[model samples]
Target: MTIIRRSLGWCAGGLALALAATLGGTSITTAAPPEADPPAMEPTSATSTPGENYVALQFGVFMHYGLATYVKKRPWDYDPHEVSPLTFAPPAEMDTDQWMQAAASSGAKYVIFTAKHHDGFALWPSDYTDYDVASSSAPDRDIVQEVVDSAREFGLKPVLYYSWLDFYKDGGSDDEGNYHFVASPEYVQFAKNQITELLTEYGDIAGLWLDTAPGKFDSGRLQEIKDHIAAVSPTTAFVPNTHLTEKRGGTRLAPADVLVHEAELEGDLPCDATRPHEQSFLAVQPNSAGWGWWSFASRDTTVTTAQDVMVELMRANSIGGAAAVNASPGPDGKLGLGNVNLLAEVGALRTSPTAYVTIDDMVPPCGGTLTYSGQQTDSDWIHTRGTPTGGGKWFFGTRTHSNTVGATATLTFSGPDITVLFEANPGHGIAEISVDGGPPVAVNTYSATRRQSQPLFERHNLGPGPHTLTVEVTGRKDDASANTFVSLEGFRINASANPTIVPVANVE
Candidate 1:
């Protein structure tokens, strides 16, 4: 949930995608196969890691709940009444499992619930403080415990968002010194006491998100806290997201087990899948009209928008990092039921069970494509396109081969001169093509709208041999993946042209 990401960015809603939610009604649909793991997220035609520990998950729920939800005021509002955790607010009867099952059906693979929000209200009983759920009128119920149990029953990864500074707890802050003892013993013990209970009581936490550590990094407290978690469970990821005001990012003072960057990625700050994807992850919640917990002020939150989720999905999948969309549950312990239901209806992904391609083999002489070889698993395959949601072709998420940076691909040429027909720009700027090592030749250099074209016999003469070809893509230079600005359905070889099928070598 709070695992760190590598960039600081602001994104816009250039294109809109809808999110429709479906109530998890009737009875729980007995579990089916795990929502097939999502197709592997691939970097822009490049490298691969052999033993990766993370999954490229597209859907997750972020709940900014706990006692803080009811008290809309800043989490720091200290109400020493030490409100009973459950009494924090009486929400409509909780269908905790109902929501969990809804998430499962709505394609969500994980849930990041707030265990202790920035306010430091523990959702479960903690031996550390009286300011917890146990003190709440609902003291009898362990909401966090129930949420985790329900999440597991449906196979959702339950990542906990824990805060580092407990404005209310003794010694929970970085800058405070006096009143409590510039260095009070209680303050020191409180942090440990709470963190210990979180790790020990929660079963196999998927990850821990640490927020507001202030200058704690320099003091080596970040690592100390991480060590505490490891002592309880070494397999989990200890992600510390410093509200760092620096330019580089919001990673831990030191290289943490994982890095996290929050809401800022507008420069050359690589928030996507090429180059080196930091083990970094990001939490981006796009603003509708403003930055608040209420439905992005009427418009969907960044996570609810298609374009929003798509950008994050691309950035994380390509770079091999986790992408978490920030979603805050309303004071009612719900993601604004209406909003959650909306998110469930819209889907852009073409689940693997139904994806296929059947186009020509003759590329526009711009580049040669390496056809799919094996049945790629969810994380290993996806469809890409040059447009937001238009003509894009399916390709291997892990497919990569070398053909020189500036070079185009083609096979030998021969057989007949029959004109090869395929999709390409015929009415737009110079439609170009290149094969094997030949220079890129223009097909029709003029046109109006974007249109597919039949090959030009004038420049394309064949003598029965094999040749590779590629088309120069059109769009922002930022676009790089094969799906960049083009829908790569297979290509068509001039039926009369000679052809050879060769298996590209060393592409594992």
Candidate 2:
């Protein structure tokens, strides 16, 4: 995930542009696509793998801290000269235990702390860089150590989010004036040294999360990173925020144990067999619109409701990925009352009257046939046990580049509510869908990332009767899309004689 940061002490100029890039969903600039092997595939039911545990952490907490916490502004917006170590200070009442306790109460299995953000401010004392907690006013305090210790105490796995870009180091600025360099061997080695320190010093880190793909490294450098981390922490899972799907350079990514989806989870995209997928998003507070600092005064407005948190978790679970919700601590180093209460509510749901809604594959009526078009063959309608890796059993259409626009699949079933679960990939095209001869709705099935069994279309309250759902390939993609191909996974029908609307408030 792109870090929205600015210098605490510098004038905002290029930093604003950088902040815009992160906010607008764009990377600063990445190196050319690296030549590497495709990500390895893991069975949906694989166990004892390093990533298996990480994947099981369905609900986790993400906290972004560092200079931005004190600056109370976008830390990525400031230049090197704009930042000063003198301005750094540890919270007067530092309570790492409080954070962990809150996480435990919220039923979170893991906690991922921002060990270093884009501002290049290290939460831990690093011998390789003076711009760290050790060189600042809080020289004696190691925020990373405190967090690690507290996580262990609370029985929560501890993970670290490390930024690849550093503005305060020798590579002061890239061509865009961002803190990162276009290509700097000095910074690369610096990263290795700091990572070694973190792996060697920190005891048993569950995962190492790298922010923004290394816009600089090809497979060689990426492989080097994996080797180094494996040497110290062989079991540690490596997850890169590849963002929106394609690898850093638009090619294959250097192999990692897991793949990360920053925010969006499209239905057509399936999880790669080589790596499991994770979904991380902004856990909204009352008034805060984005993922960042929230002052005590802003607490009232930035608070998030417990209902919203539950929905996010449920959605990720439905799609076979973990959800890491972002939450920031106040300057005092403690979570707000509103966040604590929300988490408590979520924890309560664990043992309450929860209805496990089972999603079943739609079986065509005995006489009805699912017609297909294009160069589609009988073999194209392949049955997959768990698509999008870990998704429910379903069938999908598969074929080569036939460019057979207008190819379609039509299904008629007796149901009041229906949902189409489709695959969205970079090459997917637009799909025209209609219900019972209703007006056609064009559903763009294009996605940068791969996800399977994504709930693409749904219609409820159709009244007791049979309906026909027809899906046709438009054989077209938006200018930004990579291809004009389309995929049809399957459908989910809710044909219950009576449907109950259970209010969360009524759940015991």
Candidate 3:
């Protein structure tokens, strides 16, 4: 927000006003810029393997630190002069290691730092520009390096957010200078230079989170950047921050390993991680508005509690992805009270492995259509669908529905030590179960209260490879159906069920 000053007392007299003309122009108006056409999205390649897991580093934090924190500004809001190489300095109390420890304390798996923002200030000592943390006074050190080092100490993967367009530095005060670099070969060279530094200096980096690349740098130039990264850090991943939808539409992204969806769930200070895409997110939930320092005393957002973070994090686990939340710090390099409190509460689940289960390689063979009524009442069923991992009980999907006073579907199977995980969704009512179509043994569908991500584990003993099996979803009392996403990720078969249970292992 630009600060404005007004003069009301009055323009004294003509002569007095003439003398005061240097002070103000009554109503001077600047010429409006031409209406440029809307963003013409350059065609981007879509994922060929759609509907598959595209998430790896799903749950992490986007650290919006640096000068922006010092001035209660957003990453792109601060001026380089405010904390430039000439004027920048760290507080004597600053200890980045402790901050990373605190975040690790909250159970995050990785950290994505804003190494460079739209504001154009470099967090590390960049030869690309002089306006950076190195310009700070006293301890003229590279802030980005410190944070990355700290992340390493905490065992959290470090990803870099390198903004291709700068609002400051190179653009200086040209306003549109940062974005108008479409044809400027200089800007392309500038970007490659910085990327070269990032890849070479930061060894063993997890990935690069590229954002806001100007139109000037086309696919060829972008590919150059990709090659540069690979040549410098072969093991590191390349993840552009298009943050596009999960569905195949509108530039879904080409060679990206991770997808970003930095969005708010409930009570959140909204930010735009959203783009022109269809699927809500490929992975990585958007951080709250409280992500950075705000210059207001207004109630920021309180809806997202620690439990909320946990629920989101667990959901990421279900989808085989991760979550990156935004926790904008105050100007003084400290987490706001709100974030600190929330993380502390979620600390309970930080290291609790039982809280999550990973499901992959589904091999459902006898699976088919599911329905409610008619002569073929959804009464009987047996299905298997999955890709094979090592060997184990895969997550089960209850694709059947009921429409009667009471409807039920049951399955009987003969397999050795195969575990089936049932997660009752919203429509799934209280249910009773039976194993191997044996005597009716009751098990709650467990879809109420503590039902956010309801789950249960069942194991059965069968033979070597193919085994007959069945499952029954019996509706009781009142009829209801949960048309919810039956989370079926984490699949664990007994270690003993290894080679014997792996039916697909020998598939050609």
Which candidate leads the pack in lDDT? 2
CA deviation > 4 Å runs, candidate 2: 1-47, 172-175, 179-181, 213-217, 244-254, 264-274, 289-298, 301-303, 353-508
Ranking by TM-score: 2, 3, 1
**Deviation in angstroms for 416 in model 1?**
38
Q: After superposition, how far is residue 476 of candidate 1 from its true place, in Å?
A: 27
TM-score pick, better of 1 and 3: 3
- What TM-score, computed on C-alpha atoms, does each candidate reach? 0.55, 0.59, 0.56
In order, candidate lDDTs are 0.44, 0.60, 0.46
Q: Global lDDT for candidate 3? A: 0.46
Candidate 1 residue-wise lDDT, 55-82, digit = tens: 3343455555666555545465544234
Query: How close to the true structure is residue 208 of candidate 1, measured as C-alpha lDDT?
Result: 73
lDDT of 3 by residue, 1-508 (tens): 1111111111223321111123365543223222221222222234422112223333566666655555445655554443433333556666777667766767766777778876676777665554555444543577778888989998888878787766654432245544435535555556666766776687656777777453343556556666656655555555665432222234434455455444432212112222111111111112433332231211333445554554455334322345665554444555555555555555654444234222233222121111222223333322234422333323221123332333443222222344434544444444444444446554445354223223354555533223323333444433344432222222222213111111111011
